[model samples]
Target: MRNEKMNTNPDAVRQPLLQVSNLAVDFGTVDGVVHAVEGVDLESAPGETVAIVGESGSGKSTTAMAVIGLLASGGRVAGGSITLDGRELVGISENEMRRIRGRDIGMVPQDPMSNLNPVAKIGTQVAETLLAHGLANRSTVQQKVIEALSAAGLPDPERRAKQYPHELSGGLRQRALIAIGLACRPRLLIADEPTSALDVTVQQTILDQLDEMTRELGTAVLLITHDLGLAAERAQRVAVMHRGRVVEQGPARQILEDPQHPYTQSLVQAAPSIAAARLQPEVFQTGREQDAAADAVADNIVEIEGLRKVYPMRGSASDFVAVDDVSLAIPRGKTVAIVGESGSGKTTTARMLLKLIEPTAGTIRFEGNDIAKLDRAQSREFRQRVQPVFQDPYSSLNPMFTIERLIAEPLEFYKRGSRAERRSRVRTLLDDVALPQSMLQRYPSELSGGQRQRVAIARALALSPDLIVCDEPVSALDVLVQDQILTLLGDLQKEYGLSYLFISHDLAVVRLISDYVCVMKDGALVEAASSEEIFTNPRDPYTRRLLASIPGNELGIAS
Candidate 1:
């Protein structure tokens, strides 16, 4: 109930850094007019961090783009006013907007890979922003770039500046983007899902850096994200958006503790840390039952013994051991979560399990058959039983195919049924994933991130396979939608008795769905234990560190 008025003066009343009111945007296309944003009102006072929370297509990103005057071609700002320090921005010519952008307001886009030019060196990109804003000359830009990288928490900034975008990790690339945004010392910084692609540790580091930089520079921030936990952790105020409108806005504590809207409530409740809210004694009793069942059925649906994968170093003294002597068993109808940092061999293990690459040494067994020895025909059959849901939904589904076609491809390739039966099956799968039947004809480009992921899940289930390797399936989804998907997976497991080898770095999520947990570090399994055991009494220091890294754990939010 903090009613802070938006400051209208550019130099008086400590001046609100940015003000946006009744904004609307539309994209005219061949099919129809796409209403991207509508009637959105937001503001950020000097040195305040405000978070915009919503599911995809809720106008969060579009609103930010509109404020910065960066909407794509054919995308028109249909209505509203945007003022940066009382300077009108809506309807301003591109040339005027260009002069304002990067100098007064800066943006950090979602995907680092696509946002940073692949061909440009990291230092040059940051320095170019400074030069364009007339902040520094070519000679001084290099020094400024290094300082900016260092300020962004990138290690060895001097060397990192010389490297291209591809050379840095996902976390580093995101930091590089931030460095470029902060290079000019803009009064307002807009970050759109900056940590969506990073692992948990890297994400924590980046967020911490943002908080520190904001405090130091006294910069106003507009953070756009689907992760409510992150918003609660970083922002002072939260705005909840849905269906192209802001449904609720309040202080961060009020929104997190007592959400006024049902959507906001569901978002907080759906968080894995919050969902696992029962008493410790109750969870322990459930764990006992799980332990007994695990002992009764110890047979492996998929097993990897002494697996090793090596990548030859380019003109180096030694090769890299991506997966070193990794051994594990995935039991039927059970969920095994593999938790690790980036480059810790989690994805490599998944790739090896899929037989995408032959292991350097060891055996992989699928239902008692050695998949490593399988021929082309046998490998195709194996693919049917073990399907994968990739991390990025945007790239996983084809842009040209309709939802029905995408889901039906697996069934058609396997020749499971007649054309009529296949169509019925596709409809059923879509329904199972809680998608509308009207979405059948829409392509991947038409759907939101969560919807596209649901379609991917529907396709994965089309095969009716025994095992599914979900690779960070819910990482890209909003909290509320993620809960629905996790609940759907649980229901599907009960119905079909399917087995899953879930991989993720989100410890809270791993605790929610996994029966067992395997901790990996440096391409090796550091520890393996039941979920309850792992949470209650972690024997390894690394495991404890990972658990400590989870936000809200120390604050009793997990309760």
Candidate 2:
């Protein structure tokens, strides 16, 4: 553990470079004015990192956006004092703030897909930042852009620079954002869940590089993340936020190890850690019923043998093998997790199982029948029985549809019941996912990330699917919401005898939910075992390295 101490004394001679006092932010919505952040006090010295940890709606990101003077439309500071090098920023003009944005205070926003310009080349974006900040001119911008991308740890910088944001992988897009944020070497950096899209090993590498770069420049970092372990590992101080207020703020170790606020304590409890045991649902705790149910089926529900997917390159004879000889099985009413880094073929394998894409070579059998061999009617039945809960709920759900329509779409699609019955089924699903009936008329945009996810789950369960392919279902959610979603899945599994083919880069999350684990690297399965055996005694070096990359693994925090 790092032995750094926070300077908390009010009478101290040294002053913070970035100071936030009594900050409040409000958003004007259709309902009325909503206070998104209130009375939040935080500060960070040069060469220091301070993290704000909270749930999805806790206003951590709002506070960071406030600091950068980039609040969304309909949002206003309301009341606050934000000082950068003793200069007040609240009343500054947009032009002045623009000047300060890239040169003085950099921002690495979440959601690289939305943040990065789809039409712009990667090099153009980085160059724009450099040129706008007067760090480089037109003549020198290209080299500087490549240098920045290289600094952000992007491989093949020259080729990557020429590609558009859409052409790069999620991890690459995130790195490009990081490159832009750190291009000018700003005095202060606001990282709003900057590494959320990255894999654990890449996350560690990026954070390490960020640490080194910021240290050299004496930059202050205001990190907003839902990840408690990452906050504890990377930041010197941690602030606990709840319902737009800073409930507690102190040294990282003190806040996480001995959380004072009730909200903070709940966050610690809900956060999935490597030290935590596999969470058992109420039904599973008493193994008698579950054991008997498992015995009755006595066979795997889905099996993959020599599954391989190859993408032909545009101009080359060689093809890209996304999933190479991936073989795994999902038992009835059990979770079989595929854990790997980005581009390691976890999602590819899941897509194959879903029949979204065909395999170049291999077999995917569902209930002793090859999915590829299914006829039209059989395929329709298979589609009803096998469903998917995607990673980003906001993207997955149709914004035009109400919660009722979204959940009941599948029921209506297969014409399972009358309109009244489908609506009734939607209500039942809402209860199954622990959502209120009042949400039926609400749009997807009106709900929080967790609520949106519940709705997605409800939609998946609309047809009473035997198997649900959950592709990083809870990765975008906060700790509390992640725990809730996992619990709901477990309960639903027990009740409906549902099987799960789970995919995630989060090892801790995988540890909590998975029954069996398969580790993949470079499009190949490196290791497979029971959850207990895999985590307790990983056989492969790649698996061990993945485990070791988990943030705060060294702290040994009690789960």
Candidate 3:
């Protein structure tokens, strides 16, 4: 019904705008030629959406990259047929592909922060696409840029065009990327996890705008994502990929209702859906009073009272208030999650708790000691006791270091044990985090995103910290990997009594992992309650909106 304006009639016979047949892609690694995608077949009609759904390393992105002729270095189409508008594209030259790129096939890559030019203004980037494609000249480029941004649902497009990517939030940056991708009004749009990093409300807004624009343009879409709920909601057809192959392909609703493949079934089960019950029901079954009584018996691991952070602008009279009078507590061995959109002060609050940034005002008490007033020795002890597992595992782990050394770095810094003992500890930590001991020799680049995140967790656990600040730890991960990581975190907490300061934009994830949830908006706490209370009976309007915006809420079908 959401796609009624577009051509989504399955019974109608029509030529596909884009097509691929028996596509195989290979990457020349140091070891050998690795087949990344094999015998894959896909197609998308004009004004239709086809989603490739899979876990990380399942070759969905590789397929998209191959389609766009932008495969990474040493990757090539080993054997495949790729046709766009009835034109073969497998053997096109770089020049020919460049001409086809913006004019016919536009891409909205994942991680807008990386895809966007950090130094270039938003308008300049949009103008480059239009100019390169001969869609706009210098005289009309500015107007075109503003129009593109406005079409992408960006507010105040004129001011936004003059600003750089860093000046925008994640959602805004994603909108800017959308603006750039659609500037030339391409026939086919390849969106690779475009909304994976965004909050639910923002994701809904972006997807709605994309649907509307693509419907109006009659553009075909190749959506590459790991989210089953997203695919079910957005795509007409879903192609399920696993280990370099399309294992199943069918209508989205049919795939969701009666998935034949075991992998597809697993994906549906693992995905955190709004309609599904919490993963850890026991954590909620214990009454809030009992948990509070336990916390009263044992001290809260960390406490914040009227915490605030202000960044002074060079010329602005009113300083930027990042975290305004935010106050919360993390009970010992319990997970207290902060859920908010980008720039909502959740991460800033976590950074302050980790002592990475000094708060402008208020108090942060860790284990009954004021962290701000700690002595040199006490500060060192606090640093050792509280560690962080940052977002973006791709950047968090040191590429040059082996997984062994990366985990051992904190142990070595703390002088926890002898060389042999630290190596053994690293192995143990890997085991604790569900990583193989054999991975100790591999570098970060050699591992998948989930494995890299596990390594980051191992490194964080190496310090034996009482509190771990997880800032969107699983945001970029697939549902299965995210479920694994969340389960691992819960198991580790139970085993080690580790407290967590979890910050994320995903309410489903927060519901699954958190004992308590703090909802933040515009640099302030709007609601704080038990996870059960927040999810079932949220009092705040923003919280209700976030819940409503979750992908599967409308479907109401159990995963």
Candidate 4:
């Protein structure tokens, strides 16, 4: 492994820490060849953070997997040269790559849930990297593992080290993965959406930790993420990829402040923070306007009174209260956003509202009726009024079914119309969501992330639902696509007078679409107020911390 240090002069150009020239990856399939990555070129300077920004299917992950020699079966690097410290890596043997992976270049994958070993203790998995590189002996490894865990900012590191991956929250699992990546103290680190699954507070902490570690260790970082605001705040340089190609690359400030590429400009404009800056003051009325509107009759659509959901652990003596006496209301044609960290009971509340799970106590009222006490037939009718749009579009939609069939199935199940009428309604709904009729025959695998999400929205709207529970619908999408989805949701609400129970961890998204905001922490509601009130004058300490944790919150506008 190369550990050459560059000159310290600001004017002096440093030698690249890692470089890839004309990289291409191919996978063989029954129908045809899948060109996952094509002629991609990227490089990182020593001690500099380089960000790769792109939408899904832009070959960002494929590039990272290729660099680390972790590509799936049937996937091969067909062409190009990958050089680390001037050494060739394209045709390196598996053993050689494995030796270099953790010792020289480490990686933090996108999804910690699947990346971690469910049955193994997190400490053991983190220590495995040190053992692989011969960095510590069995006697000393335990102490080193604890140190790594602490450095990654896991609370109660000693206790957490003994827990399995399933026992930890999503943010904690991600931190454990980072701990593993940093165990070997590699020269370069590849972090792929490290904070994608974390809440605002945890995300900020992770980013601050990563920045501090990289600066202290003088390690080069290659960050791959869909969050433009995060890239602008953390990275020195940015590379924008589109359709498996680098369409733009330059300094972060230059690209964000004065982007020359159309795609880059679109991404910057579509950023939630930037959009909020342009629209916040207008959408959030002043004190006078709010006072005037207060006298106007407010329309109420859905109400909950002390809703509680408790789950009993099989071996545990006590039950866990996922939703603890949560109470809130959703106004007609308004969006109510629920913000919280993982295991904060956001999803559990949504499940109770959907009636998918029976609440241990409390009342759920939909349009002045007690939904919790409803019979089976009434509950079925209530489901049609309230629909759900789940996260993970890839898994939410059935892969075997066509778009048309998937959309029509909901209408058929509700018995709202005949076959011909349902088919016509499906086409209309597709159009409403800005999807083309041509996509009706295609399967889920044939569509993009944004496209599939649009299909999911169309399916949800099949019954003309009064309220839609959007569970992080746009969190996984790119900036441009997320903007489109948000705008579409707003338009749908305006046109159809549809209400929304939006659940997400992205503060910027909440600021954009939410008329009211609810903050949750540790299975409890910290505060519930108007969006502007929550943003300007949060009564709860946790809510203030969340707002402060947003990237570039100190700045007046989005970076």
Candidate 5:
């Protein structure tokens, strides 16, 4: 938070660096004309951050794309004007827009994998921005790219420059995008959900870097995000949109603390950062059912001891220890979460527990039987009892299949029912996940991101596994939708005596669902305790650092 906030002050007068007046954008679709954005009026003065907060398909990203004249096929601006530094942008020629793109305006798109060229090295991409804008020559561009990458908080920039997008981690890829976006030193920057794909700590670091870079260059920022609390914490002014229109706009903190629109109120209320506690049992099903489930939990369903995983190094006598001697217990019908950063071996530990990978030295006991010694028939049964729900719902599912077939695949493979019975079970699973029956016929691409995640959860439930391994399940979702999915998981846990080995980097989400917590760093458990103890009185310094990185920690919002 800066001492002098941006986009606020009635007395001060200055020309807006970027002004969007009555911006109406539409797409010619097969069904009809899709009114993506209509009559949207907003402005960002120099060094200001005006965040457009809304859910997916609320026209937030579309508005940014249209302003930059990079609208996808079949998309066009129907009415209104978008001006940058008093220059009209809507009716400009493609060549003119290209000239204006890297020189006058820069964009940081949401997905780094799709945004960054996979074939090229990261340094070359950043150098292209500088070279295209005539900001640097071939000789100076390499040094400039390294500086940009270092400024974006990427470690070992010189080595990272030679690597491609697929070789880098998610956070590093995002930093690469930031390096490209800010390389030209543009007057205006449009960041479209720039931090959505990162972890909490990485997200905070990227945002702090972006804020510093834009402030140093005096760049006006048009930030479009779905997290209202994040918008309040980062932006000086907030604009709320629903159904392709700006419903409310005002100072950031004021808008969040005292929202005028009903839609904004719903957003604020549904935010998990605001509601720091678990969802009410009544919100799920009934208090009595939840109480009964709590009363019935008495035994440990899965127990691990001395878990150690070592990857043999290539051309070396040493082995890379991915997981140290770690031990934990998951109580029946309780969720135990493992939290850490990338390369901390959280995913490796989860994979070992799921029996997808073998551990060097470990005793994994499920109901008092060692999993390592499971016979052929028992291994098949273990697969039925334990299921995994991975992150990246987009790629986790088979896009070629319909929603109904996707859900029924698990049941069909497990031989749970006949064709008719499996279809009936698919309908029930959809209801359990709170999705629509009509969605069964739809493909994964046809549904929104949130809808696709819900479908993935439905498919996970088709087999009714005893234990579910959820790895960063809702990390890609918006605040509103993340809360919904967490509540849905809580309700499902109550209904079934299910246990969860939840793996996540988000401590806020872990606090809402997990009964116990384990913090891992560099392949070793630094601290382990109950959820409340871990959050309130963490004994380890690393745990404290992780809690400090949470965004929206200072926002004033009600439960």
Candidate 6:
């Protein structure tokens, strides 16, 4: 439970913290003048949170960037007035903005991995903020850095400070970003999708930390996110953006319960968390939904026993066990999701199941065949039987290749058909994923985040594999696009009788898509049960805490 309450004092705020009126921003691109934001009006008071919700390319991030005076080249304020406590910031000089940035305004950018320098130590990054702002002298900077990390919920800040960005888990990296954002205790904090990359438990911890700190410091938060549930739960006021304009703005509860705009209504109804079709067997299953209990365990498509993976320490004789005696079963044509923190071995188990990584001790039976004992020819065939959709689509996709080539490469690798035939298969996969055939000629950089993920899914399905391992497929997408991808996967599963070994940290998404749920922690399975049992009545303490951590779990909103 939270030790303190924040977002609890609306009446205490009398003075306006940030005010933006009739804001308009545009980018001069090679295509032409692109109007990113138009006629936007928003305000936030001290000790308050104003959430701006929208899908990607809906001007939410652009508005925040314009307010922060960090808009990239070719982008300028076409029309608008941005003021902080009566001080104009839109036309401010860079040097002046730099002084105001950390001292008066702090920001937590969306992408933690790219925002952080790969070569620098995390401690140095945190200390640099305090030193640059003249908040602390060199003598006390190290201690201040450790304190910031500790406050951000990172355990053993002393050791964590020396590690680089790659050495930490995704959750730790996000918390590091948070520590940097709040190191100066700025009057205004611009947080853009702060918890979008973290697991549920870690997301709650980070949000709680932010709420407490902001409340204590009287900092106004301008949150830019696509999660309607998060806005409904944490924000004092909600602003919904459609296309390039704000269509609705009001109290959080009022906006979520009774949205006035059609765009807002569509967003709420399309979200997977609202109805949770995955936990309901009747909705997720086919005609045999009622007979699931009567089905035998032998109906599983993949079975594992005593799975263990150990990696040797750098210099020590000891070894690190990533997956410890983990066992699970994936029923034929059923979706079983594994949920856990980043390093909890969910990905490791999935990798082993796909034979991408070998297990030190265990037996993985795929269709009653031991994957470990497969010969060269059999292994080659196994590659065609199983496919994987990685977590990061941009990294997974090759920038040099067009979307068509990326999808056709798998078909060509397996020698499934001729050049013309492989081209036909790629088109069919594009149609199945709801992508236009015209997009085949474009490179990965030309597509948006959601479109790139869709292309990745199309590539994964090019082989028509019997089992597909989707690792955090929809974590980076907005709720509307996430729902579309989920629906596509479900439809494909039913049409092709495909089985899925889904791995994700988002429990709300897990509950919405999985027939069975497996909870993992510290490289072990803490609990495994049907989706309904896990969501409705989790037995394990860890599982219960996880259930309690879903964003907006405590709120009750009307339809």
RMSD, every candidate, angstroms: 4.1, 3.4, 2.2, 3.9, 4.1, 2.8
Query: Highest lDDT: which candidate?
Result: 2
lDDT of each: 0.82, 0.88, 0.87, 0.83, 0.83, 0.85
Candidate 5 lDDT for residue 42: 93
Residue 463, candidate 4: C-alpha displacement in angstroms: 2.0
Model 3 — which ten-residue stretch has the worst lDDT?
4-13
Query: Model 4: which residue pairs collide?
Result: none
Q: Which residue segments of model 3 deviate by more than 4 Å?
A: 1-13, 283-298, 556-559
Model 2 score (lDDT): 0.88
lDDT per residue for candidate 5 within 285-347, as digits (tens), equals 132444465468647889889999998865668988999998887878888899987768889
lDDT, candidate 6, at 279: 33
Model 1 spans with C-alpha error above 4 angstroms: 1-14, 29-35, 155-163, 274-297, 554-559
TM-scores of the candidates in the order shown: 0.89, 0.95, 0.95, 0.89, 0.92, 0.95
* Candidate 3 TM-score, C-alpha based: 0.95
Candidate 6: regions farther than 4 A off: 1-14, 279-297, 315-318, 555-559
Q: What would you estimate as the lDDT of candidate 1?
A: 0.82
Question: How many pairs collide in each candidate, listed in order?
Answer: 0, 0, 0, 0, 0, 1
Give the alpha carbon lDDT tens digit for every residue of 481-500 in model 1. Answer: 77777777877777888888
Best by TM-score: 3
lDDT score at residue 161, model 1, on the 0-100 scale: 96
* Model 5 score (lDDT): 0.83
Q: Mind giving the per-residue lDDT tens digits that candidate 4 earns over 450-476? A: 999999999999998899999999887
Span of ten consecutive residues with least summed lDDT in model 2: 281-290
Candidate 3 lDDT tens digits, 1-559: 3543455555421789899999999999899999999999999998898899889999999999999999999999999799998999989888999999988999999888888999999999999999988898889988999999998878899989989999888779998998888888889999999888788878888889779866777789999988777887888889999999999998888887789999999888888765555555654633367456755686788989999999997666989999999988888888889998878999889989988899999999998899999999999999999999988887888789999999999888879989999999998999899887888899999898999999999899998899999998998999889889998998898899999988888887887888888999999999988788888888999999888777765555211
